[model samples]
Target: MKIGNVNINGKVALAPMAGVADRAFRELCVRFGAAYVVSEMVSSKGISYASEKTISLLTLSECEKPCAIQIFGNDPPVMAQAARFAVSQNPDIIDINMGCPAPKVNKSGGGAVLMREPKLCGEIVRAIKDAVDIPVTVKIRKGWDDNNINAVLIAKICEDNGADAITIHGRTREQMYRGTADLNIIKEVKNSISIPVIGNGDIKSPEDAKNMICKTGCDMVMVGRAALGNPFIFNEINEYLSYKKKLSAPTIEEKVDIMKQHVNSICKNKGERFGITQARRHIIMYVKGLSNAAKLRDEACKLESLEDFSKFCDNILNSI
Candidate 1:
């Protein structure tokens, strides 16, 4: 599938999840066979102020070359400036986050708050598009709320203003992550637009990914929270889509190996001290279905050394 000139070889993609889609997690998904991956939402306002922590989120490695850097904000000129800075990082695409439901983001007049202002959405898209040579895309929810669902209208305005593609999360801003995703809205957006439409929301398994594409007629499907601990979902969905064969889930041993690799990468990127804190949380994700998963989560708080993590992985493998 192609977004403008950028070609993503497969149909399965990793969604740009805030506080979740970090460099380590993104690289894991890419190596495991996610055709596309996006960075966490960057703050346009933060970029304007040159915040180091915020700017660090835009880092893209050589291994993740075809990745996109996503940005969120309210003002047009500030968004344009952010796009310029993001372009310097040499990402394959630039995505505008008009879909985030965080109270902080929305209350500040960014994210899903933009869904209520279709004209501002156009200006923002146009501003970014005009400022960068790379393809520009937008991720959006179905609408602001149930009663004022207007994905089609906002999508049209975005398209008119030069958005190369649109991802339609099938719930309103009001629903957040609750309730079922409405495929009909995604279908309507796909049918209504000429660019590629990526369908998101509630896709937990390979079968769910297939059903989403078949049902919505979307070009690709983006997985968010479903892939938190399970980067293997990308490979599973890709293999199934390509060969009509379902891949087996990871064994306890296999999961441990991946976990160790992920932790090491985090440590190498951040310092050892911060890395332990960062990777400790993911241990619970890896041991999620095991009998002692809850205990593992509590133990995570005290995890201080690589030896501690190694022992934790061994315990899960041995016990489960």
Candidate 2:
């Protein structure tokens, strides 16, 4: 699929998950065959102030090429400026985050809150498009709530204002991450827009990816939480979509090995202390259904060093 001049090589893309889809995980997903990956949402206001931590979030690597840097804010000028700065990161695309359901984000008049003001959404899109030369995309939800189902309207507004592509998560902001995503809404948005539409929400397996495309007629599917500790899902989805082949799930030993690799990369990038702390949740996801998962997860929370993590992995291996 082509989002403007950017060529997305696969049908499955990694979602821009805050605090989870970090550089290490995105590079891992790329290795596993993700067509494209988006960075965690950066604050436009933070970027305007040149916040070091916010700027760091825009950092790009060659391994995760064909990637996008996503930014969020209600202010058009700030968002445009953020897009201009994001270009310096050398990302292949710049994405606007209109789908975040977090209360903090909404309270700040960003994220899903912008859905209530479609005109502002258009303004923000136009502003960023004018500020940057690369393709610009927007990630949005079905709407703010059931009473306000206007994804088609918002999508058209975005397209009319110069968005290159639209990613529609099939749930309303009111629904947050709970409940099933309404695929019908995704289909409706796709039918209403001339730009490529990417579908997201509740895609947990290769079959789910196939079903999303078949039902919604979407250009691609974006995997979010389902990909936690499961980068192999991209490879699985690609194999199933391309060859109709079903690969078996990774074994306990294989999961441990992959998890260690993921952790090692995280440590290498962020330094061991902070990386290991951040990796605790990822470690829990990797061992979710394994035997002694409870004990392993308990130990994972206390992990303070690579040596502690090594011991935890040993226990995980010994359990099976």
Candidate 3:
């Protein structure tokens, strides 16, 4: 699949999760066969002010090329400026975030709040597209609420305004990841727009990815929460989509090893202290189904060092 002129090697893409889709995780997923990945959300205001921490979010490795940098802001001029800055960084694509349901973002007229103001949303896209040579896309929710499901409407608005593609997460702000995503909304968006539509929400496995494609006629399927501890979903879904074959889930040994690699990779990139905090979050999820997982998760979250995590992993590997 291609977003504009950018050629994605496969249909599976890792969604731009705010805190979880960092450079370390993206590189890991790309290595595991994800065709595309989006950076975690960067703030337009932060970039306009040259915030060092925010600028760091723009960092992309050579291994994660073809990755999109997603930015969030409601102001057209500020967003345009941020888009220009992001383009200068040379990411594969520049994606605008209109889907974040966070209270702070919405209160600022960004994120899901933009869903209520479709005209402003179109204006933002037009501004970004004009500012950059790369493909510009928008990530949006179904609508503001159950009563105003305007995904089909906004999809056209974006396409008409120069967006190369649109990613639709089929839930309203009110739903907030609570209800099952209405695939029908995704189907409607695909039917309404000529540009490519990527379906997102509740895709937990290869079968779900296939079902989303078959049911919605979307060009791609994006995985968000489902990918936190399981980057292998990309390889599994890609193989299934291409060959109609189901790969076995990673073994317990493989899980611990991958978790270790993830821990080490992040620690190498982001010093020990912060990396271990992030690792604890990721490792707990990676061991979600194992024996004594709850106890281990509680214990893991409190451990403060890389050596402690390595010892924890060793114990798990030795036991199982």
Candidate 4:
């Protein structure tokens, strides 16, 4: 699949998850076979002031080619400026965050709140399209609420305004992450749009991924929370999609190695203290379903140095 001139070689891409899908995780996903990845959402307002933290989120590495820098805000001019700043990082695409349900983002007039204003959505897309030369895309939800579902309308508006593709999460802002994702809404958006549509929400297994594509006829699927401790899902997905083979689950040792590699990368990039702090949740995830998982998670939460993590890995390996 292709997003504008960018060639996407696989069918499963990683979603832009805030506070989770940072540089270390994104690169790890790419290495494991995600088709493309989007950065955690950066604020257009933050970019306007050239905030160091916001600018850091736009950083891309060569290994994660075909990655996008996602930005969120309500103002057209500020969004356009943010797009320019993202372009400086040479990302393959610029993704607009129209689907975030965070109270902080929506209360500030961005995220899924934009779904209520179709005209403003169009203006935002058009402004960014005009500001940047690369392909622009939007990630949206079903609507603001059940009674106001209008993903099809917002998708059409985005397409008419020059969005290269549309990614639709199948629940309304009101639903947040609760309940099942409505695949029907994803189908509606796919049917309504001319550009590519990537289906998201509730895809936890390779079978779920296949079901979403077959049921919705979407061009691709995007994995979010499921990929947290399981970047291996991408490789499994690629193998299944390509050859109809169900790859065996990774062994305990393999999972430990990947976890260590991920931890090391984070520590290398962000320094051991901050990286280990950020890696706690991820470390817990990697040990999910394993024997003595509760105890392992408890130790994971207290990890402060790479030395602690190395000893932890040894314990995991020795326990098997």
lDDT of each: 0.91, 0.94, 0.91, 0.94
Between prediction 1 and prediction 2, which has the larger TM-score? 2
What is the TM-score of candidate 3?
A: 0.98
| TM-score, every prediction | 0.98, 0.99, 0.98, 0.99
Clashes of 2: 0
Q: Compared with the true structure, what per-residue lDDT tens digits does model 3 show for residues 1-320?
A: 78899998789889998777888899989998888899999999999999888988998889997899999999999999999999878898999999999999888778988988889989999999999999999999999898988988888999999999999999998888898998999999999988889999999999999999999999999998888889889999999999999999899999888888898888887889988887787888898989989888998888789889978988888888
Model 2 Cα shift for residue 160 (angstroms): 0.2
Candidate 1 lDDT by residue in tens digits, 1-320: 89999999999899998777889989999999988999999999998898988878988898875899999999999999999998898899999999999999999899999999999999999999999999999999999898989999999999999999999999999999899999999999999999999999999998999999999999999998888888899999999888989998898889889989988888887778888898876766877886777888898778998888888777777785
**Candidate 4 structure lDDT:** 0.94
Candidate 4, residues 1-320, lDDT tens digits: the string is: 88988899999999999888988899999999999999999999999999888877788888888899999999999999999988999999999999999999999999999999999999999999999999999999999999999999999999999999999999899999998899999999999988999999988999999999999999999999999899999999988888989999999999999999999988887789989999998999999999899999999999989999999999999989
lDDT of prediction 2: 0.94
Error of 1 at 206 (Å): 0.8
Off by over 4 Å in 1: none
Candidates' RMSD to native: 1.0, 0.8, 0.9, 0.7
